[model samples]
Structures are given as C-alpha cells and as structure tokens.
Target: MNILVTGATGFVGRRVCARLQKSQSYNLSSAVRQSGSNPPGSEVVIHEVDGQTSWQCALKNQQVVIHTAARAHIMNDEVADPLAEYRRVNVDGTLNLARQAAEAGVRRLIYISSVKVNGEQTPAGCPFTAEDAAAPADPYGVSKLESEMQLRQLAKDTGMEVVIIRPSLVYGPGAKGNFATMVRLVAKGLPLPLGSIRNRRSLLALDNLVDLIVTCISHPNAANQTFLAADGEDLSTTELLRGVANAMGIPSRLIPVPAGLLQFGATLLGQKALARRLLGSLQVDIEHTRKCLNWTPPLTVEQGLRHCFEIRQD
Candidate 1:
C-alpha cells in the first residue's frame, strides 16, 4: 500500500511514520514544510508545500491519506480572530486535501480530529459518544468539526472512505502542548491545588493512539465511521498528577483547594477560562470504537504516565 502522511514532521505524525517504517512492505510519502526534520528510518518522499497545493501532487496513487496537519491550539491566541485562521487551515485546507485525495482515487482518508469537537466538556453522568451533537466551544474545535463535515460530504460524493479518529488529551514522549507543560510542572515539585476536583477525564497515550490509528487505517469496521479513542479508563486531575509524580519517583504535593475558591481566584487574576478547562471533566465514551473495531488500548494510565516520565528524564 502507498500511504501519504501530512504533518509527518509533527509529534504524533513523526511517531506514526516511524511505526510505518518499522512495519515495512509499504511505500511512504511524507508532506512537510521543511526538509531537514524528516522521520528517521522512513525513506519518505518529502514534498515542500502548504496543505492546499501539497496534497495535489503528494496524494497521487496513494491508497491511504492520513491528514494530521492542522493549526494546533495556542494559548496566546486569546484575543486573535481564531475562527478565521482556523477555518482557513483546518477547514478549507482540509477540504482541499480531501478533494485531491478523492480525485487521485485514494481509497481511505484517515483524519486525526480533536475530541473537543464533541463539546469542551461532556455533562455529568452523560459521557460523549460518536452520536452526540457536536457543539464545539472553541474556534479550533469548531474548525475540526467543520472539516469533518466536509470530509463526510466528500465521501458521499466520491465514494472514498473517510475515517475520523478523535483522541483525548494525548500525551507521551516528545509531546509538546498542555500535557507536556503539566508533566514539567509536576516534575519540578510544585504544589498544585487540584486534588479537590472529583472529575474523570479520558486520556490517550502516544503508543495507544498510534496503535489505534494503524488499526483504523485498514480495519473493515473503521470505514465511513467516526470514533472517539482513549485509554479505556478515566482519571481525575488529582489521579493524573499523582501518577505523574509516581512516574517521576517523587511525592505528590497536591492540595485540596475549594473549586469555587480556585475559580474566584482565577477570575480575579483574569485566568478563569484557563482554570476551568484544566480542572473540568472532559470524559468520552469510546465503547462504539471498541465494539466496532474490536480494539482495546494496550496501555493503562499508569503505564502511559510511566512511559512519559521515562522518556522525559534527561
């Protein structure tokens, strides 16, 4: 099979390329903005162009096109017109790539979407499922949802298979984002007052997410389906932090601050938005994915945490 991977130079994309390389017997084409940081061991045909034009040529004769590229979340984009930019890249560019892939007779287009597309936080006792109404809270999430809609339309029009994988809070070695920041904060022996929250949120390990993506690539059940993926278990902020501490071989110093007080303080400091998401319940019910794909995440929360700590130790 000939596969094309966009965002092949990114954290998850690099890992996926590496896995594809090791598995062998397939031709790999990687699209990147730059040429120097290609994934090791994969003899990737690197094409330098933006997503709109890049895929026009890079997707030729490809059996599967994994669209992992996107305008990733940025905390500093607080006041910017996030919707416009996000739509341009995440929605428009995604459609362009999908169109090219369909035109090139690509069979499957696996899109790596964010779980945020199913609303920022699922209601208490009402875990999110693939059939849930997609109410994206942020511009980034909205963009992803819009792109998924476009992919569905393209699939209907061209008869190309579209598979969507929504992963929650993915973290592991070399992961850079909010999760990485949390790991660093815990590693520094900082006292965090997150123990009071009793919310459960699902997470994705790099290894588990990679495995799931590979499964989705060829699994007969994954065709024309959207799946939410996680480690199959939920962990509270306290549990996650404690696990991180354990992984780092350090004692957790979690304090039990009142949630109201924390919110009040954050409001006073103009960071309430940040505090709520950090200490909120973002659970997802991935039962459909497991049942349909007949897949289970091999890594537990503890194991994933340990792997992150092990790799981050330098």
Candidate 2:
C-alpha cells in the first residue's frame, strides 16, 4: 500500500511513520515542509508539499493520505485576528490538501482533527460523542470543525473516503502538550495542586491513537466516518497526577488546593485560561470508534505512564 503522510516531521507523524515502517507493509511518502531527509528506511520518501502549489504531484498512486498538518495551538500568537491565522492553515490548508488528494486519485484521506471540534471542553457527566453537534468554543476548535465540514463536502464531489478522528488530550512517549508539562512537574518533585480537583477527562495514549489511525486507513466500515479516539478510560485529574508520580518513581506529591482559591490565584496571575483548562472537564466518548473498528487499547493507563516516563529519561 502507498501512504502519503502530511506533517511527517510532527510528533505524531514521526510515530505514525515509525509504526508503518515496523509493519513492513506500506510504502511511506512524507510530505515535508522543506527539502530534507526522510526517515532512515528506504521505504520512506520525502516530498515538499505545503498544501499550496503542486502538492498533488507527491500523492501519485497513493492509497491513503493521512493529514496531520495544521497550525497547532500556540500561546504567543498575537495576530489581530487569530481566526484568520487558524483558517489559513486549519481550514484553507485542509481543503487545499483534500482537493489535491482528490485530484491525485487517493483512495482515502484521514484527517487528524482535535476533540475540541466537539467543543472547547466537555462538561461533567457528559462526555462528547461523535453524534454531538459541533460547538467549538475556541478559534482553533472552530477552524477544525470547519475543515471537517469542508472535507465532508469535498468527499461528495470527489468520491473520496474521508475519515475524521477526534482525539482527546493525547499523552505517552514523546508527547508534548499540557500533559507533558504536568509529567515534567511531577518528575521534578514539584507538588501539584490538581489533586483537589475532580474533573474527569479523556486521554488518548499515543499507541492507541496510532492503532485507530491504522484501523481507519483501510477499514471498509470506516469510510466517511467521524470517530472519537481515546484509551477507553476516563480519569480524573487526581488519578492522572498519581499515575505520573508513580511512573516517575516518586511518592504522590499532589496537594488538594481549594478549587476556588486556585481559580482566584490564576485570575490574579493573569492565567485564567490555564486555570479553566486544568479545572474543567474535557472528556470524549469513543464508543463509536471502538464499536466500528473492533479495537481496544492494549496499554493500560499505568503502562502508558511508564512508557512516558521512560522516554523522558532517555
């Protein structure tokens, strides 16, 4: 099988490439941003395709196009209109790539979208499902939702298979995000004030997310499917922190700070956004993904955490 992967240099893209190489079944073509080298194996091909220009040339005879490229979340983006920046990359760029993939006769296009497309955050007792109406609260989430719409629309005319996978906070080896910062803090023996909070959130282990991607790549039932991916385990902040502490070979050092006080302090420190993210729930329901793919995560949360810590040490 020939696979063209955009964002092949990204964290998830690298892991996806590694997994595909290990399988020894698919030919991997990396759509890179620059004229650079591909992964070590000769099975990998690197081509520059920034979603503009003649990007479709790289997708020749590709069986599947896994798109992981997007303008990810950034803390320091000071554009007068953040939506424009997000649309340029997340929406316009997506449609551009999809059009090119369609023109190139790619069989499938798997879009790695964020769970935020369901909403900026899920509420307590209500994990967002694939059936839920999109109500993205942030510019990034809104852009992703728009892109998904565009993909659906494009599929109607192109006769292409479009699969959308919305993953929650992903963590594991080489994971860098809010979760990574939490792990690093725990590793450093810093006491976290998250223990007091009892917000349940969904997390997708890197391995499990990769498994879902592979499943959707060729699954007959996955065509034009919108799925949510996770580890099938919903964990609270306290449980997550304890797992991190255990993985780091240290005693749990989490303090149960009062939620109100934490919010007050966050507001005073000009970090209300951080406070909301930490204290709020962002769970996703992956029942549809599991039922459709007939898949289950092989790694437990503890196992995933161990892998994360081990990778951080190396």
Candidate 3:
C-alpha cells in the first residue's frame, strides 16, 4: 500500500512514520510544509497549508492519508482573530487535502482530532462517548469539529473513506505542553499543591495512539466511524504526579491544598484555565472503539510512563 502522512515531523506524526517505516510493508511519503525537514526513508512533498494551498502533488498515488498537522492549542494566542486563523489552517487546509486525495483516487483519510471536541470537561464519573453530540469548548476544538463534519460530507460526495480518532491528553517521550512541565517538576522533586484534586482525566500514550492509527488504516469496520481513544485508565492530578514521580524514582512531595482555594488563587493570577485542567474531570469512554475494532491499548499507563522516563534519562 502507498500512504501519505501530513505533519510527518510533528511529535505524533514522527512516531507514525517510524512505525510504518519499520513495518516495511507499505510505501510511505510525507507531506510537510516547505519549512519542515523530510524524515529518512520516505518521499517528501512540500506545500503551505492555508486557504490557497494545493495538495495535488502530495496526494498522488497515495492510498491513505493520515493528517496530523494543525495550528495546535495556544495558551495565549496573539492573533487578531484566533478562530479565523485556526479555520484557515485546520479546517480549510484539511478539507483541501481531502478533496485532492479523493481526486487522486486515495482510498482513505484518517484525521487526528481532539477530545476537546466533546467539551472542556465531563462531569465526575460521567465519561464522554463518541455518540454524544459535539460541544467544542474553544476555538481549536471548534475548528476540529468543523473539519470532521466537512470531511464526512466530502467522503459521502466522493467514494472515499474517512476515519476520525479523538484522543485525550496524549503523553509520552517528546511530549510538550503540560505533560512536559509535569515531567520536569517530578524529576526535580518539586512540591505540588494538587494532592486534594480528585478529578479524573483520561490520557492516551503515544504508542497506543500510533497503534490505533495503524489499525484504522486497514480495519474493515473503521470506515466512516469516529472513535475515542485512551489508555483504558483514568488518573487524578495527584495520582498522575505520583505516577510520574515513581517513574522517575523520586519521592512525591504533594501538599494537600483545597481544590476551591487553588482555583480561586489561579483565577486571581489569570490561570483559571490551567487550574481547571488540573482540578477538573475529562474522561473518555472507549468501549465502542474496543468492541468495534477488537483492539486494546498495547501499553498500560504505568508502562508508558516508564518508557517516558527512560527516554528522558537518555
């Protein structure tokens, strides 16, 4: 099979490319922006992703396209209109690639979406499922939802297959953002104030996500389906920190601060959003994905964190 993967240089895309390359069963090509470097052992096609970007060259002779590129979530975006900017790159750019892939006789397109499409957070003990109506909470999530809608329509109009996977809080080696920050804090044995946070959040390991992407590429029942993926485990903020500390062979020094006081302090400091992420529940139900695809995460949360610590040590 011939496959083209966009954002091949990104954290997730790099792993996807490496796994596919090692399998040695398919011909791989990478579709990257003009500024990105090509991964070894794959063909590279360069194009800007915007309202006017052309994907004809990149989509040629490709059987599957796994799209992972986008304007990722920014804590404080300085753009005049963040939503419009996100739409231009994420929504418009993705649809353009899908249309060109269809025209080039591509078989399937796999989109990497965010669990934020369901909502910012779920009620305690109530997980978000794939069947729930989309309730994107931010500009980034809204853009992904719009792109998914458009892709389904495009798949129907053309005879192309589309598979959507929404993953929550992906973490592992080479991870960025909050995960990276936590890893650093744990490595240094810094004190944390999240010991009282009882909220549970679902997370996806990089290996698990890559495994699911590979499965969706060829699974017969994956076409026209949307799935939520996780490690089949949920952890509270304090528990997650302890896990990280254990992985790093360090003692956890967590102070039990009340969740409400923490939130209030964060609000005063303009970090309420970050506080919610730490103290709120955002769980996902992957029962449908497991039953439909007959799949399970290859690695457990502890094992994944161990691997992450090993990589950090190296």
**In terms of lDDT, which candidate is stronger, 1 or 3?**
3
Please give the range of 10 consecutive residues that has the lowest summed lDDT in model 3.
Answer: 34-43
Question: Which parts of model 3 have CA positions greater than 4 angstroms off?
Answer: none
Better of 1 and 3 by TM-score: 3
Q: Give the candidates in order of TM-score, highest first.
A: 3, 1, 2
Candidate 1 structure quality by residue, lDDT tens digits, 229-284:
89988988888888888988999988999888888889999996777676678888
Best by TM-score: 3
Off by over 4 Å in 2: 40-51
Clashing pairs in 3: none
Model 3's lDDT to the true fold?
A: 0.91
111-220 in candidate 3: lDDT tens per residue?
A: 99999899999998999999999999899999999999999999999989999999999999889999988888877887888888999999999999999999999999
Query: RMSD of each candidate?
Result: 1.9, 2.0, 1.3
